[model samples]
Target: MGSYDAFCKLYSKGLLFTKPIPLKDGSHSMRNIIDQLKDSLSRALTIFYPLTGHLVTKKGDDAPSYHVILDCTDAPGAQFAHAVVDAQVADIIAPDDVPPIVESFFPFVGTVNNDGHTLPLLAVQVTELVDGIFVGCSINHVVADGNSFWHFFNTWSEISRTTFRNNSNSEFVPRPPIVKRWFLNGQGPIINLPFTHHDEFIERYLPSPQRERFFHFSPESVACLKEKANAECNTSKISSFQALAAVVWRSITRARQLADEQITHCWLPVDNRLRLDPPLTADYFGNCIQALNATTTAGELLSNNLGWSASLLHQAVAGHTDASIRAWLEAWVRTPFVYQYGQFVDHQSVMFGSSPRFDMYGNDFGWGRPLASRSGNGNKFDGKVTLYPGREGGGSIDLEVCLPHQPMKALELDPEFMIAASPSQAF
Candidate 1:
């Protein structure tokens, strides 16, 4: 593992995918769906077999200080559950105000592996609704990040579609993914043995009235924001993602209403694969990401226009080069283990991550495209914001913002913020 991978927080993430009705006639039976899913998953296991394994600790000379390794030799198969719910596909997609999106959407209850049950790193829950099925996945973060997770999901879907057509395993072989974690100069990745992670910084501090909201920005709205941001910066160019981030940062900053001298920061995850000197392929299949933070005080952030914030984001993003990225790794080795992205954050900070280029709309296991895609976000705290593409099929974007109660309500009331995001119908 690289220096950063060793201290990767041991947590689980859940993904919810709903498959609507009108399957190829015979494919809707609960038994048939489960059978097909299990068989295809079994085939997929041969490729992503490492995920089936559990993490075992290699004790050091110290007490709780140990190296955690992925041992897949005798791994139990990935967990799968077949549940039938009485809710309709429409309700599942665009429910009226009901429950927390993550709480009600994902099938998994907890985000930890050793929280009582000896859980597999990967588990799949096939929830059958009155109209279709919801594929809820619980995956350990140690083994995969967003890129690797989606790769596995898409591969499984491909295998299932092939099996559904031919009913034979004779013609399907997925390309092997690189599993070797990179280490620098033959040096070890783990520095602080069994890093001690205390309670998250946010849980103890963030004020009451916490909530998660899903907001949709259509392609037209996104374009308008980009145009406005570019105009404000006196620069003719700004990306859709940058523009959206600027708007969000401004809205959240205004809502929080921090003192003039108080500072706020925004962190964006930069995919290190492409930033490396010798770039990794799209399928490098690991946590090849780093966060780029933009710092500004409330007076600076809210006082200036959206374009100023966007320009700062653009500079941070453009500042990453191949040599700089390598140096980033070197610097971390000298600093400390566990690059806690949340370390500098407080109630006033906002950490933003967006996978705008990911093919979130393409995973079709025969029942057609997903109306929406969501991360159960078990590890996220208030002031965390994640972006996904809007389901409307254009250049739209989906923003899922988590914040304290008052600030969230303030965002809803903000005219500029409300103008961009419509109520998400099915996310």
Candidate 2:
């Protein structure tokens, strides 16, 4: 794994994806659905065998200079659970804030936050609702990114629907994931055997209190923002993502009222699987994302218009190239104990993640399409904003934001922020 990727291993926040699976009949009881899911996942383990494996770390110093390897010897099968909530499907999709009820729908591994490197790196929980079933997954971030994680999810759904409809008990083929590390150092997911520096990075930082809120940006509003941003710069055109992120970043900075001299950053994770010199294939899994950032003083971000923020985002994104990615990899190998940049990024840094590219709306598993989707509780961090395709499915964007309570309230009254936003009611 890349040193930067190893940092993720220190924390065990996995992606949780939930979609309402339609109930066929009374025969499709929670027990029956759970059984089918268990069987399908058991079969899936043969293909995604690595997930059945666990992460093992050798004793090391204070930071992430230790040897952390995947131990596949013990086959602790992925977790499977079933729960019945009083809420109904309609109640879940109601035009309101993401119900706090869905928080209990998540199924974590070992414990909610376990530092132990035991086996069974993956787990699933089938949350049963009044009229529908919630299929939720919690896979370790070290094992996958948005691309690989969704690949595993869709593949599991395919196998699930195939068996549910055909009821065939025969061997099935699942699209297997490639385990090779890309642009990483070492052999077999190991290099520097001492992670003391990473340990310090974790201990050095104190987490600030945060509150999460959901916001909506219709397709028309997104287009308007893009149009305005494009109007700002003739040489550099910002993408829709740039425009949206710029707006949110600026809005949050203004709400917080950081000092003019204070430096704030927006951590934007770039998917490098397709941006490499030769480029990685679609199936190449593991953490292939590198966080690129835009740095601006509080005064500049608060003083500028949305388009100005978009231009800064565009430049930050434009800074990444094939050579730069390769250079970053080379530099990482030369300096294993320290990360050259992104060290100061903390609660003050609002990171933008997820995109329409994930196609959450396209995931279908024998049932009708999902009415909505959301990231697991793991994503709730101060100054974090996630952009997902709207549940309406015509390319509108939904923003899931987490901030301080004061900042969130400030955002509610922020005219510039509210002019283009509505309440997004998907969890």
Candidate 3:
């Protein structure tokens, strides 16, 4: 394994901890909360076990370990705490709208910034509102997935709520810590899995710059839209997600026609955490396993009805013979031929992330549940949509489109492209 590969192996096996300031029962103090976290945090680490590789370090800690960002952003009405919460997260701070906190979360592929440290491994920030507080974070991709992070957060919340006295067994036990050792001799690209037709893959999804922007289906809108599409397709199993994906695929193709490009790569993340036998714990730390480069022709993707499309995606997932895809990915990282973008294409580049099931609105980190909560906004994306389950069976999705401001203006004008369900209908 190259140093970078070995580094990744050591790296992906990390975890993140989050604390939502709970509804203060009128007597708890910040010092009291910190004191409790200090005692219970490490113990909670045990529940997250082996995958919790190393406790993150600050700027000059005496350890042979690396550091990550713990960025914190402020809410519209949040009271800023200089040492704990800042007006913006650490990455995006500039002449550009990108906040410093967003910039801090970029991966450390070996670029130094003004801070002297690699880009943040942990991003810590807060969303302040009259109701309660929201703490936002960005753990390194190498270390944990959203499930694992939420698992840890739930445990921390449990401990904090009970003042470190709640001792119920969590859903999963931790694994053994990964020991880092040299395995390769060279560097550059270190993963190699066959995606038989890479450009063909790209052409299907990322065809044009116009399609490479963001689009969202509000939770309220998505639920109703899915129902309408299901009735049109005559299939009850057609979930909002499947329907949205189909529309996104179609819209992207339309965008490509306008832009006159044929990029075709749509990289969708497959959550393989539960794909394992005896489903992994929500806190099963480390990079569990993810499948990327799922591709299909635009014509094929858009022509299908909701049921057909959902079934198609289901089939692709079922056919993945590499049940041990995670191990395969880790082992593949040892080679240098896997990360190549041979004969790059400009089709459609779409990334999809399922929303995390964190009960964010209910998170009361001792100050009472937040009146409202939201994600930090320093990050940006093009042609990507993140899905989160909402108040009921419904859900919220965050979209980051890279279209020029003018297209965005056009999108707003076209009500059919984006619409929301009534509040009564929305969960």
* Total clashing pairs in model 1: 1
The lDDT per prediction is 0.69, 0.69, 0.40
Clashing pairs in 1: 209-405
Model 1 lDDT, full chain set = 0.69
lDDT of 2 by residue, 1-427 (tens): 3453433322122222343444677435556667777888887778788778776766555554566666778767687777778778766666344566766777652232123265356767777766767777777766677777777777777787777778776565545688766544333444664344335433222346666567888888888888888887754478988988988888888888788988899989788877776788878877677778898898988887788888888888888988888788776666655342246346466887766666666666655567677556654567867767887766688887887789889988888899989665544
Better of 2 and 3 by lDDT: 2
lDDT of 1 by residue, 304-366 (tens): 888998999899889988877878767776664544434645788888764766666776665
Model 3, position 115: C-alpha lDDT score: 18
Local lDDT at 148 for model 1: 75
In model 2, which runs have C-alpha deviations exceeding 4 angstroms? 4-26, 59-65, 90-96, 109-116, 168-176, 183-189, 196-209, 337-345, 423-427
| TM-score list, all predictions | 0.86, 0.86, 0.57
